[model samples]
Target: MVTGGKSLKKFHDVVAPADAAPIRTSYFIVIFGSAHLLLSQLPNFNSITVVSLAAAVMSLSYSTIAWVASLEHRRHGGSSHVVDYSMTASTSAGRTFNFLSALGDVAFAYAGHNVVLEIQATIPSTPGKPSKKPMWLGVMVAYLVVAVCYLPVAFVGYYVFGNAVDDNILITLEKPRWLIAAANMFVVVHVIGSYQIYAMPVFDMLETFLVKKLRFHPGWPLRLIARSLYVVFTMIVGIAIPFFGGLLGFFGGFAFAPTTYFLPCIMWLIIMKPKKFGFSWCTNWICIIIGVLLSLLAPIGGLRSIIINAKTYKFFS
Candidate 1:
């Protein structure tokens, strides 16, 4: 809302296709797959594994359809609506109401996620023209509409079921057997589709690292090992441990912290003290500050995550 969607979308090109290569597709798959595996193990959602998987698969199918449509529009040498946005969420810990109130955490994530999107959007489009506006506006509007849609669903769900509306909104409102069946169907389809989408970045990264950086021959042991290790890591995290808090916090703190807390502070510091250090002096200060905050919050966040879980569900031993 602070910035126009047009202004916002021009930021995606920040991550160059070449530079993004090392990220490895296997890592993404493992992470999402692991998340599925982890969530599946949870008492509430464990039974819904098949449904969740189906949801992920649906996401993939939707993405394919969307991508093909995009290609078609591209060939037409005109334009179409493509809304891109990013989201940030608490690690398995959720928001620690003590250190950062849920309000603060949510605001931080929203802002940080936006910055990531900005960086990603920095890539140039075609030769001369930048990406367009109506498309961006449509995205912004749709986000609002979706939010609007959610409000009614939230009210109806809570009013109808009280505390039953717990971790997942659907779980509360799903009173009918047929609805449960349909929901399960949707979930499995969604998981496959979404997993494939997240896997792309990891895939591109691993491929680039192997082919270009390490110069490993096709199907070489190194490449094979990398893929195998990545897959194993995914399963370990996805199934064995399934810790969301650490993963969420690590990325949120490392990536989002710089963009949100540090960047603005650095920008302010630069204007305030440009000649003091002569090189990203403000940014350096921000980095140090963030380091200190994260250091302090790391243990705090961890403890808070545990306490919060204890308070809510006796899932812990």
Candidate 2:
């Protein structure tokens, strides 16, 4: 959310006249968070279908804009800025850490696995016609779309800018001001939906704890207060840190990698009891080993990056 808002501000600054005052980074984050305050009130995942669909479209739109614009920029020799393919980090250790952090980023990009079961629950099912069949098809299609959206952007953005690209590619592309601004806006919209998607599960857990563990009455009042508080807490954290790449690497590894990479495989091994040393068993074990390594190593790089950035960062700035 903070990154999206910051990118939007950067878009404005890019197109604004030289005399225009620079926007404060914190204010836009607050504005972005405010949108979620209302959105969080949505009762459940099923209710946000339209929002989710819009978000998906916006994601594809911005990704297309990013790579396409980057390709055009490269062809036109858009700027005098030198593109260096060399390592950005000065030391070997730094380079190693960056590689680990990149793994976490890959984990994060596929973190949709965290919500897969919940999404499947929403699908209609029966004894003869199982939800898994449809859910599997949907998951496959979603991954295909993800590949389409991600590959071009990663390749073209890196090709055009090398190590000089901003974490958000829209911010790096300065020409075709209107297009970039629109892409940033698309980012904001996509993030709005994404925030809800990720948060819905957390909201469910919170509400469940309140009702079952604490015996709080299950009602709107409880929902309103709990959900709103969650939104506020996340918003404050986002504003305080506002280190986009570092956060992605950190949470992506520490939190998401297990769920995305290994947990399901573990669950399958336990539930399905795949024959030991067989193809299914071997593949799952391989994934588990890789995911565990990612979980252990990626956060070190991410936290180090965060600490480095924090040395020069100001709260809410």
Candidate 3:
């Protein structure tokens, strides 16, 4: 998320000033340095909720702009736009790797179902019967939102940019500086807010371990120091290797596949105690097998992409 914010800022900086130099260490140093100050002020969970809501609003706006722009570009016969939606032709190994990488991308898009349970936990249940209505409602709403936001942009952007699309779609839209800048600005804000939301769990775990296991005092000083260090470490890592898509692919396949697909099946079996060799049991096992295979194999393509990209990129270039 930090890398995303940095990339968008770099995008804005490059176009605004028409700078020819590549994004440098100084840019990241300044950005992350400023980020430290921003994060330091966000002390508690309640404060971050407002940030998250703000991010959601920005995200909705940006997504709408992207979808609309993509359609307009394609409809108006923009340069580089093509009707060829056929398979990408390449060597067998390359094709297979690209397919795997695409799977990872899909996984990344669809991941975060686990968060539904977390959100559901906060919703009030009925007095007598445990209400699953709220949870399912949330899931349905989330999926609908994802589909609405993703499908049009993915289809129309591909139709417009074809194989020439940048990793960041906003970068591909060169015209209408005000629109692109607005979209990128929101991208930065949304990512910054999202970084906090995602990282808060890790912070909670680390602080719990420190205070309980290591006997550290549970105070603002320790919290500030630990959280600051964590933020710095993440920024350093982001600066060192700026491969967002590859990282998404790797994590989506290796971690999210299991969390989203396999673990749920296992949990279902344990909870329901279904027939040992029933149809439901067999289906769950098949899902588990597929999930396991995806987790093991899909990351290969992501790793390969990382290596290939790394060769052309300097430490901060």
Candidate 4:
């Protein structure tokens, strides 16, 4: 929610500053609520799959343009907007907090590991050999392609805009107005698709829980109302705290460290039953320790970023 809101905010800030000021909580809730309600009308997951594919293509197009543009900018000797790339904390504690928040943003950016299993389930396998080959190959290819797409864009965008780069890279490209507009449209399409993909699982879980608790199997009307309410809830929360990097940082550090890193280490240790103080045990323990430390520290950074940014934003805004 935070990330999406931030992306929207950045787009408005960069592309249409004159009409940006009224981008407050009410506006976000109305627009996002309408979008979610419309998307929720889809009958099933298969529809979402189609949307996700379209999103992938659109995202790829814009990302490629941004990546190439950054390289071109650097080649032309355009000065970078970022002055420092060191790991050390900048002068202020708030800057250090924002830095950690940025780390969370990076974590969110690479967070597809959890979805691989979901994706694997979609691939068909033959009976005889129980061919997991396709699944493995698909996952490998996807990750490889993502890495190829992301690395150059990140490196070049940072090289070109440095610290000045907005959270959404496409916003940095102001030239070639038609292309930029097209890229922004792609961004909107991708965001809509990606939003459905991410939110559907959450919506399903909530609906299931509600059905159980309320002791009623909701018909389509009730289901629609329930999901629409959830969407509104998300929009309200996003409106309240619209700090994009901070939310990414907090969720990444606080949630992903456990799900992505810490839990796996513990699971391996338990399942393998490695000897205490042995190499396997030591490595697992080390990972757990690091994960715990990161989980503790990352949220603090996220919180600070939120605090700093919140001062400038109206609660309704």
Q: Best lDDT goes to which candidate?
A: 2
The lDDT per prediction is 0.41, 0.89, 0.73, 0.71
Clashes of 3: 0
- In candidate 4, list every pair of residues with a backbone clash: 82-163
lDDT of 1 by residue, 1-317 (tens): 00111111112112235355343323433434444433322222233445545654543443333333334433554233342222233453343433443223332333322322332354355545545454466446545643454445444443433442332333222223343334433433454433333333454467678888878775545544665555455554443322344334444444445555556656657576666666767556756686547534644554454455446542211
TM-score of each: 0.43, 0.97, 0.87, 0.80
Q: Which lDDT tens digits does candidate 3 get at residues 1-317?
A: 43565546655564666755556644655584567556754655566777878877777887888878777776666654345555463688877887787788778778765455545555678876565876787678767877887787888788777777766678677556677778877777777776776666667777889999999998888788788888778777677667777777777798778888789999999999899889999999999998888898779878877887799888765
Best model per TM-score: 2
> Which stretches of model 1 miss by more than 4 angstroms?
1-124, 132-135, 138-142, 145-164, 172-174, 211-213, 218-232, 242-303, 306-317
Clashes of each: 50, 0, 0, 1
Considering TM-score, which of the candidate structures 3 and 4 is the better prediction for this target?
3
C-alpha lDDT (0 to 100) for residue 85 of candidate 1: 26
TM-score: which is higher, 2 or 3?
2
Residues 162-228, model 2: lDDT tens digits: 9998777888888788888888888888999999999999999999999999999999999999999
Worst 10 residues of 1 by lDDT: 1-10
